[model samples]
Target: MTRFRLRSGVVGVALLALAASSCASDKAGDGGAGTGADGVKHGPGVTDDTITLGLITDLTGPYAPIGKSLSQAAQLYYDEINLGGGICGRQVETLVRDMSYDAQKTAVAYTELEPKVAALPQFLGSTTIASVRDRLEASGPLTLALAWAPSVLGAKPIQMTGTTYAIDVINGVDHLVKDRGLKKGDKIGHVYLEGDYGDDSVAGSKYAADKLGLSVVEQKVKPTDADMSSQVSALKQAGVKAIILSIAPKQTASFVGVAATAGLKVPVLGSNSAFAPQLLATDAGPAFLGDFAVLQAASPLSADLPIMKTIIAGYSDKFPKDGLDNGVMAGYTSAMVVGDALKKACENKDLSRDGIIAAHRSQNAWDGGFGSTMDFTDPAQPPTRKTYLLKPDPKAAGGLTVQKDNFTSDLAAAYPVTAG
Candidate 1:
């Protein structure tokens, strides 16, 4: 198992530098104008006619495939919005930065972006978000829209547009247990990366096991673990009824492939982060078959959904070369949420940080183009706690098939506290 250790002071310095540049650009007479409380004109990226939104992604990091797709989707949305006369007579512009999936780089990128943009639409990855949590909280009034699950818990000025890390895993487990009618004391095996991401799932699985009367057996792996035979062999010997995976695409696919070769046929369930269509298609192939399930926070990109159709058309028209993925949908939805908040802020012609924050919190039943609905009336709470389950499509080869649509039945009543 590969453990990532980040240098704190270096990340801080990078963030400080980025923030200074972003704010510095907001100096006198750039373009549009709004006066601050001190009677200073609104900075460069902002104008009376436009709002600049910032985005940070791991464009060249381990998660580059997902990051590139997300950035393309966000840019496409901006293009479409602008073409349609923009929001409330003002166009939306996105400033994107590549964080290279490094915590330090992500911190520096956010620092550069936070002061210039009206809001941060999407900050990708759990580790990246954690690195900047302190700075975000201390930055005062600057909020970020996040795509990572852990960011939902105890993260303020940052709203997650999906279920919390622990909650989503629990939801997946609950579905399997209820559907399969697994008895109390049924054995469940978990394979996960040995970091914050993996730890979150382990915690969630334990909670669900206690609530639903199942017994959990865990196997921890490093992010760089390419061989999962040992773990799969252990689980097979344990006679586990089911398996839950909490790792990235490469590792998850490896485990699935190895388990299949070892003749272990138990149903496998995974967190939302595990659903990478391209990776699954290329790495695991038909080996995954019908034995895997994934959680989705956004609506599926199936051509049948109206919102998805629109998004695909927009993306294809604007970003012809970049293929769509779940992260693309996540990025688009994040921007849409920010757009909603901006619309509300414009309604009152008050663009203060406090005003935008209030507007976001008051939002309820927001349709975010994913199966789940969002309600963020409490800033200190998780925004969306609903998730949809997806199964690997045996017939379609590489694609995912939706097993349940809008599985939000438990979200409203199950989770009581905001994640932190």
Candidate 2:
């Protein structure tokens, strides 16, 4: 496992105080420490009554459904918190922007939000976030990324709410070998987008294949390439036992629908972002119900877990027109983490960005009423290796059912995820 080092607590606290003091303007304001009249220390995006966070997401691209889901669920959580007196006597507000899954737009969004928000809890894509990672490392807010690529874990302030894409693939492949009757020397097909998400997932598949004596036949595609007839044909000719997907919902639907029509009946598995609840209303819906599963870090909104019951009821009531999906669970959980960190910072009386980061790093065994507890002490490693394997279901809430809850195969647990 790879690890990134943060500054020592004492040094960080002092430096943060100095930076806040040096940057503090003489004029009264709400975004900087000592800028307000209350005498309580605050940071950018913070005031006497509100703490503003940024939500940079894709609302017009392939990931729009997920972005919407995340935004809505997070808002619901924040509303609940505000109703209950909020964190540190302040209401949480979000400065939202639609980056459309574009890196350039993300850069612009970051520039616009960086000076006004205290933190970011929903920066949506690996590629988009990577575009601005350098700036983030230099002076970015405490960010909770919606992406799962291992590379995102390198930044000090950026944290993922769940396991990486690589671990998800490792667990998915392990299930294929142990439970799906795949044997040594078998061929497993991988169709992925050509970026951090795909590359990391392929890395996991290769590692698991090497351990299980299986061969990986890879097919890389661009996000714009929606038709999967050729890729499906190639994998069919390769005679692969199963296929792993690390693309978006459009690609997954096309691949599965094409494969089904091509007479290739193999187990199809996907990363968390590969499927959306809206897909169940499409022509590919039937194919998704057959031999297709997804790996998720959080439980579905329909999960039997107690917290899920509250989330589902609240979400249905809050967003009547929107459909429930895994993004709802993911967004709510990420907000929960952010709220916890803010509360800790309040207790320390240092709600500055540095204080928030420090508070987040101290969490070692935190549970958000999810199935698994996470350890956030190590920013380099995923908080947990346990993942849920889910299957699409037309009748289920979130349009999916959990096949394996909080499962971690031996291979996944043993794999060493390193920095690039």
Candidate 3:
């Protein structure tokens, strides 16, 4: 509102703004906004002082702990940004929903959140994301993919953090050979759920085995089916020297527990989704004391790297009493990537969903403080071939020791973009 004092001989001036239709039509999705005749632009979830984003995670399901930790970590960054006046001077606010790691429920949640938020920064479950993608594409929100399924490459608004699960597998297998002195022809065991996530990991392992002239014994388990005893039995009977697991935390717990009961003692390598902080307290915790290793693309908290240090300091300062682990640290890093995109979107004052997507296109080998380089220009291509190696360290940040930081293998070149 404007107030003015005018004398009888003086004239009062009225200010008016003109809407630029060309610019209005030039923003991001059906989620685009209307430009007022007065030149005030209002996009979905973007207001004078607030920009709303959505977060859909597995709050109450098997990945609940992960979701909770991730959300907390994201909030830490978002809150820090907010304290600094946020992006474009609008406070960043994320509306979170728990889909319980279910695709149908995620679809419902996405539909509910689509009309109200500019983008989604946290979406867990690769297969679940795949199941509900039609719903997502219909109302395109820039989504940060927690699941690294190769099928996600080139999918609009879905930026994958790490390489595909298959590639992660390739790196892990090669690591075993070089670091663990795993010889060619050594029988390796694979225990994974029956889904895209599992398939991607298995593909990498199989590809690496073929290249190295080794053999693999696979034990497929359904996510819904809890019994891993049979799978353990099969691998044990095969005289597998080591095992790789590409499953969730609950499934991981079962794998470790069931293996011990079956007297199958071997080093277990896990994919990113395979480890959780709470797993250390489970009955199988003892078995994983030092026997379990999780392969990831992000730097572990134990690293002296700037990104890890920032996450640790910020997280500890923000939520001191809560434990810091991989799940939460991963969440923090994901938020950092999203924050970078948002900052870019703020330019030109067009914060529409489409504008955010465009911001990604300009990204080339973006560090995002995680050390992995990401190229969003060709979203379909693999972003990075690097992997971070971490072993369980309860006393360390994220409960893992950083054995390697963004390390690549000679066999990494052999990994293909098979996820697409």
Model 3: lDDT equals 0.74
Task: Give the lowest summed-lDDT range of ten residues in model 3.
Answer: 14-23
Which of 1 and 2 is the better model by lDDT? 2
For residues 128-216, could you state the per-residue lDDT of candidate 2 as single tens digits?
Answer: 98899999888888888888888788777888888989999999999998889999989999999898889999999999999999999
TM-score list, all predictions: 0.86, 0.89, 0.85
In model 3, pairs of residues that clash are: 28-354, 325-398
Local lDDT at 288 for model 3? 70
Candidate 3 lDDT, tens digit per residue, 12-57? Answer: 1110011111111212223338652334354676766667777778
Candidate numbers sorted by TM-score from highest down: 2, 1, 3
User: Stretches of candidate 1 above 4 Å error?
Assistant: 1-45, 140-144, 394-398, 408-412, 415-418
Compared with the true structure, all predictions reach lDDT values of 0.68, 0.82, 0.74
Q: Find the candidate with the highest TM-score and give its number.
A: 2
Cα-based RMSD of the predictions, in order? 6.0, 9.4, 12.6
lDDT of 1 at 334: 73
lDDT value for model 2: 0.82
